[model samples]
Target: MRRILLGAAMAAMLAAGGVAPAFAQGNPFQPLVYVNDSVVTRYELDQRMRFLQILRAPDGDRASAEQALIDDRLRLFAARQMGIAASDAQIDAGLAEFAGRANMDVEEFTRALAQAGVEQQTFRDFIAAGVVWRELVRQRLVPQVQVSDAELDQEMQRVIETPRITHVALSELIIPAPPGQEAQAMRLAESLVQSVRSEADFAAAARQHSATPSAENGGRLPWAPLENLPPSLRPIILSMQNGQISQPLTVEGAVVLFYLRDSRGTLRPGAKEQVLDYVRFRLASTAEANRIAALSDTCADLFVHARNLPPEQIQRQTLSQGQIPTAEAIRLAVLDDNESTIVSQGGSAEILMLCKRQSALLAGNAQEAPVPVTAEGEEGAAPDPDALPDREQMRGQIFSRKVGQAADNYLAELRANAIIRRP
Candidate 1:
């Protein structure tokens, strides 16, 4: 029954020119290998290799293609044995989502693939295999994973002890556009971006036209860890050479620009270590997110708003700079304690607030440490360990690691026990 369905699928693919003209002279349906009772066809291998090549995968060669197909077969077989299958709707959604990554719809993506001699079924099968295998893994292995508080504490300690590897120094210029002058602001920013050539030039422009408080310091910012910048801005900052100006970036009611003064490895000797305490509030609507942000001045204040909500929707954590996710780290970096920013992601909005920032030297380090200060420059208090936020983030990380290891072990076991043959 499976062979019959496979043959029909391959026949449709062949009719649609799944195999390139170069392979048309031979029987593309010939079996090259088998996983248990499942066959991996020559036509399938060719399609996969072509697809990988279109994706610019480094290992798009024949050996990689064959192994990938064999693994796909094993995954599908395992899924079937576990009575797990991807529905047509799920597969279609996956295809659409995958295509969206390349900024194309599924039909357009398929057309592009066809132009490169890969069939639509090749893409569909690939997504379906992944979807089914993920479901299988979740059901079979995810339930057994656990991360204890001890592990979380150790991970937190390790993150704090790890020194940041890279930091960037930057200057900024922000041009405020009162309700009606956005275009004028952007044009002015663009002109400055083109004219600015050196740190001195940037400083002059920043001191003259920038609205940010740093303008008084010639818009110069203290050296910041690369991870501390917004995820979207990090790559752009890294790509700039020293003394290069950035293209104008539009922010709410303003146009902003940055000048890269320097990027360096490690901090200058005796730099104070920075730690963050922040809260994340995930809400279904921007209005709700705004309301919560307005109502809360401290991380603890958010608990009132979260009382009726799911525990997962609101999180407060104290973490070293390296422990925060890049995107959140970027947002938190710019926020003053008790100030919040609403970020929209995937049909929901997150209100991220910085509750406190503490700067301290590692214990026993020879360099004298500066007194820890909050975002407002007041002496900061020690974070209460008992009041630490839920450990869901750390728990999720440990769960992912365990699930990945389990998946690899499970696949290996399946491969060892299965009857795999190459012709």
Candidate 2:
């Protein structure tokens, strides 16, 4: 819930200028509800409703919008007590980060939103409140959250003891079904699935239609491990191939369409494959691409250029051939060390530079190699117990979850104590 709120708030920061027409001076904005001393105006509620629409907020409606606005009021109230608010620089940086997700700059994203009928100030205010709330949560909660070494060991042990499983990349479109609208929702899902022939089409439909928070991200979900998916979904997911879209899946009160983007096995049994280490530089514009093409001589030189780009514009990873996207993988297969290849996706061009390569037996294979692929001197070291991979990521996830839960509970208490009245 906290993450969802943060995403909504961050979306608010996409544009920083513009103003909504104010109520006539004789009458202040008419109050809809009061949160202690703070009153929520009808105008604010209407603005929040539109804001939620842009966020593709799941279960979004006037009621949810009202609750969300009330919660934000509570959050801002708390932030005031803590003296936590976003600075002008922090807000600009947040705007840049949010725009990056859409492969755009602030001006570009704002222009896109304007075309979609969303005002600039709505995003700005949403982001400002969200930024301040995040700081408040971090300052108050993160220091108190801890993951013991034992906890990490237990998680690692679980991974080792569990059987090898496949993970999948997925996109989804969901339609909500009210008590009597089940058949209607199913029909809608069916129609949508039949019409969406390509991934871009599916994403477009999801952006306009899905009743889930992921709709804002074109229904894209992370690489979800099979075991982590619902029991009923496992069989359906297992039967899907890349680019396949599922039939309408009726679950609880929603009709869903899951698009299988990609999938891979964790243990390839007896498979032996050459793994490669590479850096993919995603340039912001063709101009940047031309500049890099002229100046870059070695794969290492890309990092020098990266210093001027946002971190999301660059990717460095080690992956087996199967893990690379088909077209890019084919290009990588022929590239020598320090050689680079270019490809375009979503209007951005990516330059992939091969760094190193090594052969390794997969997890289920009898042969074992400590390192997949690495430069000399980087390999041969015993694993450091203190330097656990994804430790910080795990800590951050856990901390965020705790903060979210704590915030939920705190907000509930605040509502209970506050003199809330429908005016």
Candidate 3:
């Protein structure tokens, strides 16, 4: 039954024009590579490549597809050795959940993939491998992960003390690349990136070749907040060390470069840009609010106090510092996570429990950090919105990153020991 489903899925993909005629001309079931005792068929390779293309992966070439399949095989083999297997139900749920990302159900997602020349079995295989690997890692590696309180405290302190960069000094140069001159402009910009080592060198180059009006001042620009630059350029500018020149950036009609003069950080008004997540529980009196506050150690504990109350009486909100009302912001600014403050709202007492505070920049919604702008005066792409986690969440993030690195290393070891070969 499973074989029939897999074949039908592959045939659907082919009939829907998923595979190219050249790929279809060959025997699709021919074994092309071997991993230990398992074989990777030519059909699977073609399916995997088509799937990657549909996903619009940047490195979705034949080599990347082959390597990915090999890795999946190794992961599955490891799972089998450990007696970790993904059940049919888990795979079905995984398929549904993955399809939900595209606002579709499993059947709809399958049809969409078929339209793009990807088989349902290819998608199922991908999800099953991932599910099995996750279960395996949870059982094997999660027990090895440990985070201490002192480490959490140190990380929290570092986050609190790190000054936010509010302003930067930069020198810019834009080389005009007209329709027919783009390659020439890019070459010139690349050359300048290598040769321009100092502020003087950048200024000289800017004055010599720059087309912007700022070129008259050796491309010198006054200190500006990253917000004033394009969203795409903020990280680039922040990444540059003092006196470092940026790589050549191609714009529509120009190739641009920047020299970082200096950057300054501030702790004051910059604090207002932070994003706060908190819970507000309405109480009948100040006394009740105080009692609840005293009993609760975290935002989750507030739910216990509100168990008998209406849902509307308890509200959770995530808002930027600037969006918060002045009085509320003042009270919250002084409170740490899980700490509470009683504020009067409509003659009733409300307990505001701080859940977490994160930098707006890290949260990816700071108005102060504007989109990126090139020296050519063109607006660049905006930054994607990201939620910045609080202390506990940060700890989890750190742990996850560490675990991921460890898993990668483990996988590398497995690959090293396995007998992988081309047929």
Candidate 4:
């Protein structure tokens, strides 16, 4: 299933230049297929294929591009049925947004795309379809997604109660398993693993071959503790060292290979691991750091002048050391309670004050301390009205995923009932 982004669709057309208008009789608008009464033209199919090519999709296969176009037509037809066609202004807005990604204005992007061979109208149509479908999904699917306070609290409690574990920084390549194509995908994945010698090579392979959304980022996963990983994959991860690639492992509906980038031990705070109380202050200039060093006698007074600033600008949190990102663990570890250290990440420097540290267990093999479940008749404790930012982000992520799945399922239903014809 293609997630039709306006930018990607536009890129395809621009990269391919415009489809040659000259046909058998100098006529380009030839019917390639029909979905019910709506038609997909040969010119449109060729343009989409070129778009997919510029995307560096697997093999730039014509069949896949054709399938994507067919789906786009279906999406457009559905939009009309719902009386929700995109306005011309909406299409322009989408085109402008897409151009912004390339740091270009719409006029500049349009000229560049034209030079590359894509027609302005073709790009506009692509943007219109995506814009309309997005509106349709927002109207139909978003209202159905709900994340209750109880659900958030239960998850938060679970995270706090789970013990800390060694974390592995990993990247993955996932090739889709489309029924009869499973064996072929596995063989390809195996070949990739054998040929990839470095992180760059693996990332390049992922961009060209992976079917997962993460392919856009070269399959890099966020830093995560091993305990949070799927049980079946954890053992295999533990066996591999940094920079090592794993053999292809088949999971439900896909074949996956992992590359271990780095590893570290961390405590997950929500799992109720040992909490490290710390004060953090962000620094913008060396002068600020120097001024603070000269004036502050203790960690408490370091932020005395900045107390009126936003709390998040200098907030204090009691968190697990294991919960600290692998990159900052070393700097934070060397400090004692109330002692402070300075570290810079992504060009921004910050000072960390170690307020307190509690030992729950050693570096490895920490056992879980069970949280008591209340009796069936008693009312459970009211969930905190204020959920963490991470919890809110997770909720949004879950909602988006549900909407995507609902869109796919809705499209499948449309395909099932429509009279689809191909020539």
Candidate of highest lDDT: 3
| TM-score of decoy 1 | 0.48
lDDT value, residue 193 of candidate 1: 71
**lDDT string, candidate 3, 269-290, tens digits:** 3434678999989999888888
Report the Cα lDDT for residue 23, model 4: 26
Q: What's the best-to-worst order under TM-score?
A: 3, 1, 4, 2
- What's the lDDT for candidate 2? 0.70
Regions more than 4 Å wrong, model 4: 1-27, 57-60, 153-262, 269-389
The collision pairs in model 3 are 18-117, 227-370, 230-371, 230-372, 230-373, 231-371, 231-372, 232-372
Q: Please, what is the TM-score per model?
A: 0.48, 0.46, 0.48, 0.48
Off by over 4 Å in 2: 1-28, 167-256, 259-371, 374-396
Q: Given candidate 2, what's the lDDT at residue 52?
A: 58
Off by over 4 Å in 1: 1-25, 166-390
By descending lDDT, how would the candidates be arranged? 3, 1, 2, 4
lDDT of each model, Cα atoms only?
Answer: 0.76, 0.70, 0.78, 0.69
lDDT tens digits by residue: candidate 1, 1-423: 223222222322333444334244357899999899899998998888888755534456789989999889899999999999999999999999877766568997788788778889999999999999899999999887777866765565454444434899999999996765654675577579768878888999999999999999989999998979998788778777888998766667877899988888643333345678888889998887888888888788888888988999988888888889898888888988788899987778998988877543322222223457889989876543222223466567877998999999999888888899988
| Candidate no. 4 TM-score | 0.48
- lDDT, residue 54, model 3: 53
Candidate with more favorable, higher lDDT: 3 or 4: 3
